[model samples]
Structures are given as C-alpha cells and as structure tokens.
Target: MQPLLIYNTLSHQKELFKPLTPDHVGMYVCGPTVYGDGHLGHARPAITFDVVFRYLRHIGYKVRYVRNITDVGHLEHDADEGEDKIAKKARLEQLEPMEVAQYYTNRYHAAMDALNVLRPSIEPHASGHILEQIELVQKIIDAGYAYVSNGSVYFDVRKYQEDTKKYGCLSGRVIDEMLSTTRELDGQEEKHFSGDFALWKKAAPEHIMRWNSPWSVGFPGWHTECTAMGTKYLGETFDIHGGGMDLMFPHHESEIAQQTAVCGHGPCKYWMHNNMITINGQKMGKSLGNFITLDEFFTGKHELLDQAYTPMTIRFFILQAHYRSTVDFSNEALIAAEKGYARLMQAYKTLGRLQPSKTSSVDVKEYRQKCYDAMNDDFNTPIVISHLFDMAKVINTVNDKKATLTQADIDELKGVMDTFVFEIMGLRDEASSDNTALIDGLMKMILDIRATAKANKDWATSDKIRDELGTLGVTVKDGKDGATYEL
Candidate 1:
C-alpha cells in the first residue's frame, strides 16, 4: 500500500522513488573489478542490487540495470600509482592481462549465477570501451576540469571545486580539509594537489596493458570508466546508481564530479549504497587475510567453516538483515540460518499437500500487504522473512488440524509464499524434492520392506532397517497416519 522509499546516499535520507520516466527506470550499479576469485565480500552488492532489480521489475517498471565490469584500469592499492590489479596478477601467474581478466570474470559470473543473481541488462567492460573513456577524458579537459601533466591526465579538483561545490556533497568531504590531511598521491609532482585523481595514467615501459590515449600510452584511470560507461549506457542522468558503501567516497564521489563537470548535472536521481559484510566484528577483505571466498563457503574448504553451506542458505543469511545494515558472518549464525531456511522451504512444499477445510482460520490476505510493506520500507527483507515464517507456522497449524484453511485461502497463501519467498526475496528451493526423487523412490521401497517386516511380526528385520538408517542420520517417524522418513 505504500510507495518504495530508497535511502539516497547523496541526500543522506530516505525519499520516495519516483522514476524520471513514467514507465521506465534506468539504474547503474558499480560491479566487480574481477581481478581475483569472487569472495563473500563480493556477494553482498551483487545480491543487494539484484533484489533491487527484481523488486523494481515486480512493481511493473521496465528496468534497464547497467552493471559494469572493470576488466581493466583498476590499480592494486586503490591508488593511481600501483600496477593494475589484473595486470599484477597476470605478471605473477605469467599470463596475459586479458587472460587473467577473462579467467576471473568467468569465475565471478559462475559465483553470481550460483547465487541466483540475475544478469544485468548491460554488463559493459572497461577494456571494451576505451574510446568512450578517452572521449570523456577529452571532454573534461576541454571543460577545464582536468589538465595534462607529464603525459598523464589528472582531474583539477581545486579548480573544479571553485566552479561547483559538488565534489564534497556525496562524501561529506571539505576540499580544503582534504588538501590539508590528504596523503601523498602517486604523481605528486604532476598533480596540483594531493587530492587530485588520475583520469588517465601514463604507463611505464614495463606495463603490458597500455593503450594509446590522448595523454600517453596508458590505460584509463580507475574512476574514468564508470563515468564514461554509465553515461554511455544509462545516459548522463539516470534514475539510480548503486554499489557497496565502500565506494561512497572517492569512487562514487568522483563519479558525481566527473558527471557534473562534463554533463553539467549529477548522474543519477538516487544514490544507493549497500553496507558491508563483516566476519568476527571485522571487515572481510582479501588484504586482511580474513576474507572467505564464496567457493570456500560453498565447499567448506576454509578452516573457519563448520560445514558446507548451499547457495540458498547464504542468500537467506544475507537477506536476513536490512540492506543498509552490516551483516556479520559466523558459523553459529549461518547454521541457524540454514536450519531456518530449511524449515521455511519444507513448509512451502508442505503447503501443496494441505487439504482445505470448509472455513478459513488465518488471514492470508493480510500477509501479502505485510510482506510488501516490509520490502517497501527501504527493502527491509528481515521483516519480510519473519512474515514468511509466520506463514510457515500457519501452514503447520493447518496441517495439524489445529487451524483450518479454505481453498481460496490455500491458493492465497501459496501466492504469498511464492511472491515473498521466490519473487521478491530472490530465493529458490536449493534442495528441490525432485532432485532426490530417485533416492526418495529407493527409500520408499526400503521403508515398504520394513513395513512388511513389521506386518509379519519380524522385529529383527524392522530393527535392522531402523538401526541402519539411524546410523546414516536418516530419521524415520512412525505414526497412525502414515510412516515417513528423511535424510
């Protein structure tokens, strides 16, 4: 019943989401650099923006979500001085830079696909758009917002600050304060100020990924590709721009300045940032050596893991918190999430087998609104998940004959589950019942043999079957209704 309210990183407040166009929405999310294997840190933004993409479409907006892949021009230390992350990796592995990029990009895509993150409408690669980046660099130069120094192009932050006081707005940074406290940049002699950032970096002779640009034989700056590619795909001004909260300053901030400097206005109507994921109250990152890769989580290869977690369990764990809130990782927390997810999923399957009563006992209609309300409240997925659990309880009560459901209520409940569980939450049944069909059929025949044993008063054979299954952690429940088993 309420409109979606998005927290704008620009304004630092929650505002109603009104698309620029009546029926279409354009959104740009900063994607992976793909210099290494995808980690749990990488899963957050992909899943976060993925829910946004899905929810927008579910609400009937024709959405074009452009998420760019930084296949080139990303430095090792998040600074202009260091070698490209991909290039550095390539050097260590004795491979071409493009080869390294392609390998990791494939790995990233596979990880994302496992997480059920829908592919964006346009996934532009920086290496594929060197011309557009160069053109944008030249535009900034002509606009007097950038200057050529020592064969490299640097943004004139001091000069640009004088024209428009827009640089510090997104990051809440003061230009003078930044200059006073800023650390030494890579090309200190060439830059007018320490705060100045590279638009294009002049490559050294040893560098292998150099391209001929107006400035020098070099690659585009780390920040240049987003401005160029975002504008190229999503237009100079679009509806929303999103990424991790880590990109707020410098990355997203520079994006604003570049877009405003060249295009004369801000890039997007809303700036959304999802918060980080932490491990043991500390940030998870490759540099920190505390980070766990998604592969490690799925395979339980890391020493910190208790057991392997399915992709859906990981998804449920992330969505258990609000997007703006930081999610902490722990084996205990994850185990609880896994069990909770399994319970909810099992209830969903049970919903199909329920026999409707003559009268309805639960308010299924109210659930749809509550789930939507939770999601509409800045995409508060935790509350939506709680409501789903409530539905699960209802399903259990109905099955127990403690409550009742009409046929219409049954269908409505199923709709609510499908919408909140599958559609909005972007969750799928990870362990499909059909996936274990053959095993289920085998188990059924075995249990039928045990049943025959019981009918024949063969206590030894029944006990043998039960004890053998118990050793394998398979649980068999006997009741007057029927016999059931699970593994």
Candidate 2:
C-alpha cells in the first residue's frame, strides 16, 4: 500500500502522515458561524473534511475530529470591528442570540446531512467555552504577548513578533508590512499596533451576549475561541488543523501566534485548507449576494438553477474536483455532474448482475492499487474519480459480453468498488434497492386499479389516474401484457 501523503498548507508541500500516537489521529476543522443558512461555501469544507474523517477511520485509525461551531464572537466584518454576527441576526429577528444560533446550527446540520457529511466526533461551541477562552487570554497576557487596552484585551502583535519572530510563519506575511498596511477600524485607537487583534472585546451596554471576565464584562474574540477549544480538546499540539483557504491569513495566522505565545510552539503538525466554491470567479459566501443556499440547490428555487439537483449530484460535483482546486459553479457543470453520477451508479448496479466465467480477459487487481495511489497522493479525488470511471467501463464491457472475468476477479472488482465508491468516497445509491422495490409494489397496485377502471369502461376514472400520475412526474405506459410506470 502507498503511504498516505497529505498536503500541509503550513509546510506548503505534501508530507507523509504520521499520527502523534500510533493509529490515532486528532484533527480539527473550523466549522460554520451559523448566523444564516449554510450556503455552497459551507458545503465545501464540511464535505472535504468529512472525507478525511471517513478515510482515516476506514484505514484503521481512531480519529478524533473536532469541528467548532462559532455561535458567538464572530463579528460582522471578519476583523474585530463590526457587531457580532449572531447578535446582529438575533436583533434583526427579535430573538435571543442563542435562538438564532441554534436555528442556523440546526439548518447547517440538515444541509450537511443532505450532502452525506458525517458529524464530527466533537463539536464545541465558542459560546459554551467562555472559561477556556478567558484562561487562554490570561495565558497570553502572562506570557507578555498580550496586553490590556482600556477595558478590552488585545494581543500585542508587535511584541510577539519582536520576541519570537514567528508571527507570520504560517501565513508567510511579514509583520512590518502587515502593521503598515493594516486598515484603521473603529477601535484602532486602543491597539499598540494596527495589526494587533482582539483577545477579549469589552462589550457595550447594548451588547446582547456578554460574559463577566477578569478584564471586564465582555466576549471572547473571534480567534480566541478556536485556540482555546482546540487546546482543551486536542491537547497542546495535534495531528491536523483544517478549514477553507479564506481563513489562512488573519484567522489561522492569529491561531498560530496565540498557540506559539502560550505553549512555545504552534497548534498542529499539519495545516490543510480546501479551496473555495466560486460564482463568476468570485468567492461564494453569506456576505456575498451570489451565494446559493443548499436548500435553493435542492429545490431549484434559485434563479441560477434550471432544475432541482439531488443531494448525491451535489456531492458528486464536489468530489469530481480536487479539494485544493477552486470549483466554479454553473448550471451546465451541475447538469454534467448529474449525468456522470447516474452513469457511475448504473455501472455499480450492472456490476452486481454480471455473470462470472471460467476464463479472465481483463486485469482487475491493478485498478484497486491505482485507486490507492491516487488517494495517497494528497487525497487526489479527481484522479480517483477518473480511475473509478475506467473501472466502470470495464464493468460495462464485461456486462456487454465483450469481456470475461473469473469468479475470483469478479469478487475482487466488487470489493474494490464497494470500498472506494461507498466506504471511502462516501457515495451511496440515492435510489436504494429496498425503496425501489417498495415503490415498484405501490406503482403496480396503482396501475392494476387503473387497468380495472379502463376494463370497466370507466373512462373518467382511468383518465383521472393517468393525469394525476403525470402531475407527479410518473408516466404510465400500456404494454401488450400490462401497464408499466416510469418515474
């Protein structure tokens, strides 16, 4: 078997994956803010890391995957300036902040479930870990890397940079350039340097979500949540930390600084980031008007969609591209993905009904190894998909009586397809065989009733049944022997 080589964004290269402990992995990925409906952007990271979680477990590793829910502390602007996103939503909707968070969090989970994304082993909410974040702030203060500014506490980027000279290592940003180029926000007057970020923000009297901390009545800064929660759950250093590429700069860079300041080292061994889903080459996000919610895609309610696309089609569309590559959304692209998914599923179905022969004409074992190779090379999903397509061709050819496979070879092919397509890649037949059988039985009964109506010359009843079935997107065909339905 090829050794798994994951691309570490920190190292900027693919490295052999070696868990801190044998056969155990601790991975953390930044999850949604949950202030609004989960859009196409949210789906990318959830599906990407879900595959990582799935593959690690499949390969005999016990993985602890922690994805945080940012219910609070994330400001309207990504920087520490604007109103809290959840709080703003709460105010607009005339509900408690937690109510807004809970509603959106539930919606996010539903969207992820529809995409077949597995739930994380641990999902810690930032609002729930106030003490942990406060302690983290104090640690940075004790380390002399952060300082109290008025009632708020700010991480002293200049001091940290001067002491360790490692402030921008993860993001490859020079501290000097950052300080000079940093924009002036409303609270910039309190910071020693423009580049300094908030560790704790002193809440105004009107701030809905405020906690009584050692400094003041305040809330943890946006970056403080992940640092505190990750350390508490994954220990000082863990195997992997992942999120979208958009977080690489301020958010992830700040994480590195905070962890390095307190622990004298960074948080994780590897940093992984999946690229964005874009519209007209612009990043799709809640802040951006172009984002289409997962619900919109499923219902075809959005102006951009021509027809409703199933959840499986969306998942297949994401997997057809490498995680590190940008995916530009288009109606044409999605339609093509739907067709490709159908072809793949059809081939899998054909493989099950294939007959075994005494003589084998094609090699089956090599494809299994080729798939392993693709996955090992930084989870190259596009290549793995291509290999699966080739395997599907072989399955189609064998089914067409153009090639033969021994029973052993046939079994091997089945195992390979099952492991890669379902177990590892996490794709399932949308039309489950059991469900199909049930639908078939119901349709048969309905058609039988319709036939009796026609036989009895009850033209009104027969026409009504036919028209109703048509409305439901089912067509009834009268054949020589009986009636059959197409859905």
Candidate 3:
C-alpha cells in the first residue's frame, strides 16, 4: 500500500491520513435530505465519497462508513420563520411528511444504485434519532454554550466563540461579520443575536414533523441531528467527514460548532468537500432554476440534453475530472465520455485476446505503480484515468502486433487493469447492466441462426440476416473461430 494523503478542509492543506486506530478507519458523509428527486448536485458528492470508501477498503483498512439520511430538520430558509423542507413539500401535496420522506428516500436509493455507488455501512435516519439529538442538546446546554429562548434551545454563537475562539475557523468567516450579514427577521425575537442558530426549534401549530424535546414540542435543528448521529456512530472524534462544497458554509460550519461545544473539540480529523456541478459555467442549483434531475438526464427529457446518457457515461464523466473540481455538464462532453468509455471497455476485452510473443515491449509493473501513485495523491482520479488510457494504448499496440508481450507480462497487465478499472474505480460495462439476460439470450439465438445459415452454404440467407440486423443498429462480424455482434 502507498501513503494516502487527503486534502483536509479544516487546515486548508493536503495532509497524510493517520487514523486513530491502526488499520481501522471511520468515515461519515452527509446524505440527501429526501424531500424531492435527486439532482446532479446530489450525485457529485455521493459518487465522490463512494470512491473514497472504495479506495480506503482497497488499501487494506477496516472502515466503518456512516452516511446519514436527513428525513427531517432541514429548513427551506436559514431564518427562524422557515418551514421544514419535508413538511412544506408534504403540505403542498396533501401527503404525510413521512410519506414524502420515504418516497424520495427510495428514489434517491434507486438513483444511487444506477450510479453503482456502494451503500454506507450505517445509514441512520434523523427522524429515528430524536433521543440522541435531545441528549446532544442537553450536552450543549450543560456546557454553557446554548440557551433556551422562549420554548426553543439556541446555540449561543458569540458565547461559544468566547469560550473556544475556534468559531468560524473552518469557514474563515469573522464572527462579527456574520452577525452583521445574517438577517434580522420578524420571528427571531427570542434570539439574543442574529447569528445564533437553533439547536431545537419550537414547532408551529400546523407543523407536521414535531418531536417532544425537553424544551418544547418541536423538531431538531437542521445542524444538530448530524452532530448527534455522528457522535453516536463514529464516536466523538473520527477520521473523515465529507459533503459537497456548498455545505462548507453555514450547514457544516454550524455542525462543527455544535460538536465542538459538546465534545470539547472538532468532530472529524479530515473534512473533505467535493465541488459542485455547473451548467455552462454557472452553478446548477434548484433555487437558480437550472437544476436537472437524474431521471431527466436518463430519459433525455430536459431541454438541455441532446440525447439520453447511460449510467456508465455519467459515472465516467464525473470520474474524468478531479473530485475537487467543478464538473460542467454538456452534451458534447457526455458524448465524448460515452465514446471514451466504449474504447476503454473494448481495450479491456482486447487485452484478454492479445497473444503473447517470445519477448515483451511494455513494462506493465511501472504502469501499476503509477496507478497507485495517482490514487494515493489526494485520490486524483483524473490522473488514474489518464494512466488507464495509457494502458489501453499498450493493449491496442500489442493486439495489432505493433508491440509484443510475454505470457507473464500479459497476465500482469490483466490483473493491473482489473484492479484499477473495476475494483478501485468501480466502473462497469453499460451493456452488462442494461437488460443483460434478455440481450445475451437474444444475441445467442440470433448468432446461432446465422451460424446455421453459414454452415448450409446459404449465402443469401446468411447475408440477409446480417444485413437486416445491421439495419436495426447491430453489427455482426465473422472471423476464423466464430461470429460476434454488438449493439
């Protein structure tokens, strides 16, 4: 294993990862809010951390990965007058709040499944962890970092800063500046300062997702649930906490404040944030009305999409760029990714058939080390992908007799490509997942009929079958051993 250095957002530098327990790691990533369909913004962080999870396991570490489902406590606005996102959506739809949560949670899971992201070890939901959240709020109050305003408990941002001087250390915002910039609203009369955030929000009479806390009948604050559930599962101090770059501010900053108040320190050692997805160089977000859902991209239903893109193409498009870079979505980029993915898979198939010669032309061992080096340096996936393309070029050269490889080298090349392409990167062939059994059976039947026609010397029948299948977008090729077709 190579030394893995991850970019830590707290220190604003890349540092060598040193887990508290030797050969063991703990990670927690912020999951979806589950109030609506997942958009491209949701996919970026999911896939980014999925790569981190995969590569951590590959490096021979025992990992406890916990990504939480936020079913409640996320407000549409940052102010006190804001409504719960789930409750607001449910109120408009005339459905139960939990029903809305469950429906979108299933949809989110399905979309993640299509992207081939691995499930986290523990996906604790916010609704089911009210007791934990209540206990955490009590901890903050006991620490003298929070206060009860009317019926709700608020985290005293100014007082916490006075105690630790660590407030705004992660986000680099001056506490005084934040106080001036935050809104002064109609419903914030209980708060002593405009920047103070609710640890427990008193529920409105019509609020659907109310819980019984010591303070009042209300719901947990948007930022408190993560702190409670995170410490509950990954301990007070853990290895990594990951989310989108958009969350680097207020949300994660608030999370850090709550956790530090309770535990006497920041929660996680390494904070990783993946950059957002942009459209035409502008940020793609729901508020901007430029967001495109995953289903819309899959069906090519959005006006911005030129054609329906496959799951693999979407995955490859994301992986082609460094995780920390903002990936812009466009039809030309997606089409190029689809073509590049096809070429890489074809080379993978070709490597299996490349005949070994008496001598070798390429040193696959060096390429294997380079692949590891790419991933080791902050999980730079674009560099690893570039290395994969270089290997593909070697495979093509050997297959075309422009280069030669010994049997041992050929076997090593296969192992290296398999480990990097399939295991570490977690990419799969698109054809294998789309109606696999039916397509395989249909192709087998069609090829068998073509073979029978050729065996009988029925040129007319064989050529017609081949020509008609071509008209339907299937290409058939004959060789010495047999025939193969691809769609």
Candidate 4:
C-alpha cells in the first residue's frame, strides 16, 4: 500500500503522514457557527474533511474526528469587536440565544445530510465547554502570554512573540508588520498591543450568551473554542487539524499560539485546509452577501441558479475538483456536473449487470491500484474521478458489445467502482434512494407488458407503450434477452 502524503499548510509541502499513536488517527475540523443557513462555503470544508474521515477508516485506522460547533462567542466581526452573531440573531427575532443556535444548527445538519456529509465522531458545542475554555485561558495567563484587563482577558501577542519567536509560524506573518498595520477595534484599547486577540471577553450588558469565568461573566473568544474543544476531545496534540483556507490567518494561527502557550508545542502534526468555493471568481460567504444557501441550490430558489440540483449532484460537483483548488460555481459547471453524475451512476448500474465472458479482451485489474494511488496522493479526488470516468467508458464499451472481460476482471472492475466511486468519494445514486424499489417494480411490470405485446405480434400496442413511456421521460429498449427501461 502507498503511504498517504498530505500537504501540511504549516510546512508548505507534502509530507508523509505518520500517526502519533499506532493504528489510530485523531482529526479536528472547524465546523459551522450555526447562526445562519449553511452555504456553499460551509459545504466545502464539511465534505472535504468528511472524505478524510471516511478514507482514514476505510484504510483500517481507528479515527476519532472532532468537528466543533461555534454556538457562542463568534462575534459579528470574527474578532472581539462586534455583537455575538447568534445573540444578535436571537435579539432580532426576539428568541433565546440557544433557541436560535439550535434552530440554525438543525438546519445546518439537514443541509449537510442532504449533501451526504458524514457526521463527525464528536460534534462539540462551544457553549458546552466553557469550563475547559476558561481553564485554557487561565493557563495562557499563568504562562505570562496573556493578561487580564477590564474584566476580560486577552492573549499578549507581543509577549508571545518576544518569548517564543514563533507567533506567526503557521501563517507566515511578520510580527513587526502585523503590529504596524493591525487595525484597532472597539474594546481593544485595554489590550497591551493591537494585534493581541481575545481569550475571553467580558460580556456586555446586552450580550445574551454570557458564562461565568475568573475574568468576568463572559464567553470564550472565537479562536479559543477550537483550541479548547479540540484539545478536550482529541488530546493536546492530534494527528490532523483542518479547516478552510480563509481561516489560515487569525483563526488557525491563533489556535497554534494558544496551544503552544499551554503545552510548549502546537496542536496538530499536520494542518490541512480546503480551498473556498467562489462565485464568479469571488469567494462565496455569508459575509460577502454573494452566498447561495444549500437550500437555495437544492430548490433553485436563488437568482443565480439555473436549475435545481440534487444532493448527489452537489457532492459530485465538489469532488470533481481537488480539495486544495478553488472551485468557481456557475450554472454551466453545475449542469455539467449533474450530467456527469448521471453517467457515472448509469455506468455503475451497467457494471453490476455485466455478463462475464470466457476470455478477457480488456484488462480491468489495474483500476483498483490506480484509484488507491490517486487517494494516497493527498486525497486527490479529481484524478480519482478522471480514472473512474475512464473505467466508465470501458464499461460502456463492454455494454455495447464492443469489448469483453473475464469473470475475474469483471469482479475487479466492480470492486474498483464500489470502493472509489461510492465508498471513498462518498457519492450515492440519488435515483437508487428516491423510491427506487417502487420504480423498479413499475418498470418491470411495464416492460413485461411490452414483452407480451411483442410476443403476441401486436406491433401497434408495443409501439404505443414504448412511445408513451418515452414521452414520460422513460426510454425503452428492445434486446435479444428482453426489454429494459431507463428513467
């Protein structure tokens, strides 16, 4: 088996992945904030890491994947300057903060389910881990890398840089440049330096998500939640930490700083980040006002969408690009993806019904190793998909009676398709799941009737049945064995 080589954002190169503990892997990914509906931006990281989780398990590793939910302390500006995003929504709607969080959280889960994103092993809410966050903040303060001011505590970025000289190691930021250009924000006047971020913020009088801590009645900062929750669930140092490329600057950089301050080392061995989904070459995000929610994409309710797309189509679209590459969305792109998904599923069905010949005319055994090679190369999904499409063409040729494969080759091709197409890539046949049994029975009966018509030499009745079914978006084909239908 080829060793997995993943690109580490910290090292800026692909490195061989070796787990800390034998046969076990720990991965932590930054999950949704849950103040609003999940968008294309949110789906990128969720689906990207879900593949990582699936492949790790599929390769015989005991994987504990932790994805955190930021239910509180995520402010309007991701820094400590603005209103809490969830609390602001709750105030606007005149509801409790947790009510808003739970409502949107449920919606996020629903969208993820529709996208076929597998749920993480542990989904920790920031609100549920206040004590751990407070303890982490205390550790930073005790280590002299943080300070208390005005009932709130802030990480001392200047002190951390002065001591360790590694404050921006992951982000490649120069401390001098950051200190010179950093914008001063509200409630940050008490900080020792403008670049220092909040560990815990003292709750304002109107803040809805307040918790008791040594500094004040407050909540954990946006950066502290992941550090605390990840450490609590996956230990101080895990195998992989992943999120979006947009978070490389302050979010993940701060996570490294906090963990270094506490444990004298960074949190993870390898840091992975998936690139963003863009609209017309611009990043699609809630803050950008250009994001189309997953629901909008599904229903074609958004102004930008040309047609409604299924869950599997969306999943296939994302998988068509490498996780590290920016995928720009357009109507033409998604329509192409939908057609490609349909063909892939059709080829899979054809593979299942293929008859083995006495001898082989094509070699099908190499596809399995080829797929494993693609997966081993930093989870390069597009290459894997290209290989699958190549095999799909072969399957089509064989179905057309233009090629033949022995039983062993046929079984190997089936295993390759099943393992890579459905298992690792995480695509399902939407048609198979959407009342397929009923449709299969109906198609069987209709085909049987058509067969009877042909057997009785009633050409008019058979032709009428075939033409009417074709008008209803079903194609009927007559073969030597029997008649088959495609919907």
lDDT of each: 0.88, 0.89, 0.89, 0.89
**Backbone atom clashes (below 3 Å) for every candidate:** 0, 0, 0, 0
Clashing residue pairs, backbone N/CA/C < 3 A, model 1: none
RMSD of 4: 10.2
Cα lDDT tens digits for candidate 1, 118-162: 999999999999999999999999998999999999899988888
Which sections of candidate 3 miss by over 4 Å? 436-487
Query: Candidate 3, residues 1-487: lDDT per residue as tens digits?
Result: 5789999999999999999889999999999999989988888899899999999999889999999999984763565356777888899999999999999999999889988899999999999999999999999999999999889998999998888898888889888898778777755788888888888888988788998988999998888878898899999999999999888778889889998898788889999999988887788876777788998888898888889988778989999999999899889999999999999999899989999999897777788899999999999999999998998999999998999999998888889888888888889987755697898799889889989998999989899999999998799989888999887
Instruction: Please write out the lDDT profile of model 2 over residues 381-478, one tens digit for every residue.
Output: 78989998998999999999999998898889889889888888888889773387888899989999999999999999999999999999799888
- Candidate 2 local Cα displacement, residue 123, angstroms: 0.8
Residue 295 lDDT (model 1): 92
TM-score of predicted structure 1: 0.88
Model 4, TM vs. native? 0.88
> Between which residue pairs do clashes occur in model 3?
none
- The TM-score of candidate 3 is 0.89
Candidate 3 weakest lDDT stretch, 10 residues:
73-82
TM-score of each prediction = 0.88, 0.88, 0.89, 0.88
Lowest lDDT block of 10, candidate 1: 73-82
